[model samples]
Target chain A: MESGQHMLRTGRRGTLFEFSMALRDLVTSYHRRGLAWSLAWHDVVSRYRGSILGPFWITISMGLMVLGIGLLYAKLFGISVAEFMPYVAMGIVFFGLMAGTINEGCDTFVQASSMLSQTSLPMFTFIWRTVLRNLINLAHHAVIIVAVIIFFGLWRVMDVLPALGGLLLTIVNLAWIAMLAAIASARFRDIPQFVMSVMQFAIFMTPVFWKPDAFPDRHAFLTLNPFYHMLTTIRAPLLGQEADGLSYIILAIMAVLGWALTFSVFAITRRRIVHFL
Target chain B: MTDVSIKVTDLTLRFPVYGVDAKSLKKNLARVTVGGRLGASTTGATEVTALSHLNLNLRAGDRLGLIGHNGSGKTTLLRALSGAYEPDEGQIEVRGRIAALLDLSLGIDPSATGVDNIRLRGRIAGMSSKEIEDKMDEIAEFSGLGPFLAMPMKTYSAGMQARLAFAVATAVEADVLLMDEWISVGDADFQKLAHRRLLNLVERAGILVLSSHDAGLLRLYCNKVMRLEGGVASEVKDIRRLDELLAAA
Candidate 1:
């Protein structure tokens, strides 16, 4: 129905207006929570449709990695398996979530090019769908972390509350990261490949397979790595160790900076994105 | 009375071909360091102007037809109206809820069942879950794929998929309806039913913008028509006169 109101307008818009519009699109997508949740579930279910193990395959693979790496590394480092397995499990689980999210985030817009052209939904919807799908995948792999903690008798009720808080913060951080990566990768086709290679290299560089204590002389280098801070925030709490105040400070700074950067990029490129696709 | 209108003023759209220049980081960095002119020439970064300063207007009860040859920006103009492509210059103001059927099966998921695809495609068509749920029975009945609705969409034959997609796409009521081409569905019987349904939808819509190469179909459905060539549009005042011109050509 027409009420002398313009429902859609395409032309020059001020920077602030464009930014607010992009933000409004995000809010609208959130309000349509049903669509996002349904799509996310659809992604996970269809991906593992015919497999007997379904999502459990991720849990099994991760479980084996933790067990195998934990035994060899604990012995190699002169630590008990019980003490090290939980650390390895939590580290790998959280790292998998981080790296997997970034890896998939790059394809969020490119893969949805068809749907985007076919429909006029908010750009944020695709980003949220990617994040939700990765979150679901993380939930599947989390089964291994819980099992390892229980088996090693490393469960601490007091640590659970903070660990959940840290996990929430990490998820929030990754949401911004995903948005930034999705937009950049949409414009430059090779960004996804670059991100994938960087992530593969990051796994060895980050403390996923080893502990920070093992590299005392290179402690400063570890402190400078944002991935290290992201992992530590969730890993320390899960291991029943207190995360240093510096990690929280770094995370808060990163979140603020990341959102600012992502918002600017999204606002500038929101309209031009359709052309790129 | 519900009113629908679309006003486009000097709309233009250009697509950038990100060739060797911007497709890769290495090439882009080298270009930035070495300067733009040399890099641009070597990499062949060029822009394709799909739509020029084209202007048009439509109001309620208007069934406007677009006739154009291939790559003549007919699809580009329709896409611009649907808000799928943003214009590089000028302005477009659209009033009313729009349902664009650019491609019949654009959003259908093969892994999803026929029933599930109805919901997915409905949402993609800008319908709320409740709206889709309310219309589900009618769409299902119209599709005539009762038992097959439970099967995956990939299992459906091409005609079956087309029928399902057409049923869902036209089920929703909108003030503005945009279509790239006339969609024909299923066997002879279903085609008749689909034809009737399409007529009803076009009649109900406050505005309709359809693009096709068929001149006869345009004369039947549209009172006014415009022909596009090389990103420019010119009105064809008399359908008979245009037909004569086409016959001569």
Candidate 2:
């Protein structure tokens, strides 16, 4: 009887360890594949579920913004419609993606509080889903990019390959930033408001409407801004211009560091986040 | 030896409830952090102890019932047992996969239909989408939700919602079933069905711990009943154990 009691005690301890490790394992495993296209596609479909036009709403809204800004800003910066159109188009697409992903990620847990507190799933799934959903929105805006180039009659076929490379980099960069922001926003309630304010500031600061050359001597300051590098790399390639290797390197380093920091913070605070909620 | 199913020694949990703002609490915590009492004023204030040096042990086949008043640490103990809250002092060792059902309303997406929500909930429970798909019909039939399964979960009534949620949870087998309260089924028919299902569940589990205010209902289901009085446990001998006195009459 005494030996049996000891064995029972041992089994209970094993169960406790198993329960604790189960959650940890769930999180690491989910992050392995990140977000898949199918899941993101579901989010996009669910977003405009009741709407008649569906995803065309994104296209129409983007087109009007580009037309209004491209016409006004082209004259303000002394650039022709031909040059301004592609810049504004690429700017709107990339910025909209960055803004949407970062802004939405802020409330990643707050929005999913009902789900997380009760369900035993890894928290990272929600973060990746938010990022993927916004990427779908980005895909919708790509139509505007194609349309703008065609309308301006500056459609160089060679720009396609370089544009593809720039888009790939933009996606990688946005993924890292979104992961970092999602983790931070989940921890700090004020992050979404802060991200929105930054986005409002970045729109004017980024060279979306005008050329970097228009800024002349102060152009170096534009290079210093991370958004500036992101904007130029994505937009420059679309405009059939060479992208700076140094800018790509800097952005890549930021992406790597951002991921490391975000994952570490997420891992440490994973258990405690539910308490704050 | 069979191994210890649960061992909690001197476990204590304190939850800080600040009045209005954390500023006052912040100062008190800072003092305590630097090896000082939280001043006389703060010390004189009311502090509720959720759990005080809780010590518990359970072995296989122990279907224990927790009885206490509103603040008598039943829910706190359940959370601690499930690893949701870490004890302030002492360690807990549990030996099986605990399927905790404090709130069945979690993981249901408002926008998703019952089917979609099932997939999401199943995924959360580590079920692949395909696995959820295979069990989807079984869950739907078991829930008895019928045509309403296609509608969004938001449209379902509270009881209907609970049925779906409970059905999905029961689909996954559990070694240790921790129920907050005996789940309330919708109607007489549903209640009968739920009773049958619950009995089936109780047979497979190694240990079952349920917290409820209805001592009579607990006596019906649980083998041992322990009451939490003044932050300490006092086991209540089974009333049926007094059979000799009753039989003499």
Candidate 3:
């Protein structure tokens, strides 16, 4: 974030100064969109090279899990397959995006240790690099979601449009969480595993497979889970179920407050990342 | 104002040598506020003053060589100039764009072919995609990898890898050029070509700061040299007296 006037400086400062530092990093990263994009693309390409199915392998494995789990969970919950299949598929796919992003975000700067130490690239560029990789994986997973919706004859544009809106909000909120996770993991070294265990437990806790509607008595507490709100924002509308206004409100608060907290952490830790590496 | 310049005043950089326990979240959470304090002590950490009160100044057409024993902060100063590391206390003002060959193999992934490594390294050197694409043939030709450019860099010999690294590092255009160590690569033939190319790059840039252990190399490429020891620096000396400087050491 140093200016080209050839001045590079850092010091003790107020909250506004810290916030501006983080904001400046994002702005600088935005200007160098080409470098981050190429790095992310290279990562995706190199990861799957020589594999026959390439990235679709992620979709295929996810597809099979949805099928097996949908059938069994539907029978267990005593719901019809037609109605339950799309819900399960949507839940798994979108939740996978959220969880995968958080998990990978833990390694964002840690994996870029060389680049951080060697180059003058902006710090947030690595944040976007991790986000882009997850988004790419989501594209592959979208294949399963699209096929399930079409096969189940649940293709109403009206419902799909609002669902996409919620999905966008979900993505916005997750970026802050992922960014915070990246910084924390860089410092602590065990945050990635910690995030891993949290996501593992969070899947069941967040209603990815089980229907939130099934447990009427559980409504009050389920709404307390921020991730449940993250899920229903996208999943509910597509199922012809109304996602309560509270869900959007909660997600909105998360996006605002989470970013505020993340920016402060990022500002404090920005220069020290080289030492951590 | 000079087109290319570097200014440093009372620059300091210090960081802890973290122990395994200090890096653990559980251990940190256990001691709570006590952990960070414990980390500053001998059991958990050793604080390293990588550089202290280091002051330097350079302007356009300055060719400065840095000589130091291992761990004497040669790379640290280069990194600070590259903007990868900020000053801990003082200020470093650098005018104009910088191309830092701090490490030749920094972005050179062995799994990538010679062509792909060119693109990756070019981008890191701050080259735009179009620039890399337009210069692709020239870089490959200069590396002399020829048809072997299609194969993974891992398959190439060490000399070949050095050729590829050198070609990409010197390709970028910048007002300030910072190089760590004189790169010696390939057979005698390739070394001559690489030396000429490096001389051209150094001449084109407004300033150059090179760190090397070879005295003859310093005499050949630099007009002045500085010695560093234990995070401190000796006064800068002229190249004509490099022989005396080395003798004095």
DockQ scores of all models, one per candidate: 0.53, 0.20, 0.60
Better of 2 and 3 by lDDT: 3
Model 3 regions more than 4 Å off: A1-7, A10-19, B33-45
Off by over 4 Å in 1: A1-6, A215-218, B37-44, B236-249
lDDT of 2 at A11: 17
Tens-place lDDT per residue, model 1, B1-249, is: 255788998887786776654667776677778777563365444788887888888888777888778998898888888776767788777887777888876867798899989998887776788999999999999998999999999999878887898888878777777888855446987878876876786667577788888776777667667778778877544555566535442
Chain A only: list TM-scores of all candidates.
Answer: 0.94, 0.82, 0.93
- Candidate 2: segments with Cα more than 4 A from true spot: A1-45, A75-78, A149-188, A216-220, B1-49, B52-61, B81-83, B86-98, B226-249
How far residue A254's Cα lies from its native spot in candidate 3, in Å, is 0.5
Error of 2 at B242 (Å): 13
* Local error of candidate 2 at residue A125 (angstroms): 2.7
Docking tier of model 3: it is: medium
Error of 1 at A195 (Å): 0.9
Q: Tens digit of lDDT per residue, candidate 3, span B64-138?
A: 989888899999888888888866677777887787887767877788888998998888777899999999988
For DockQ, the strongest prediction is 3
Clashing pairs in 1: none
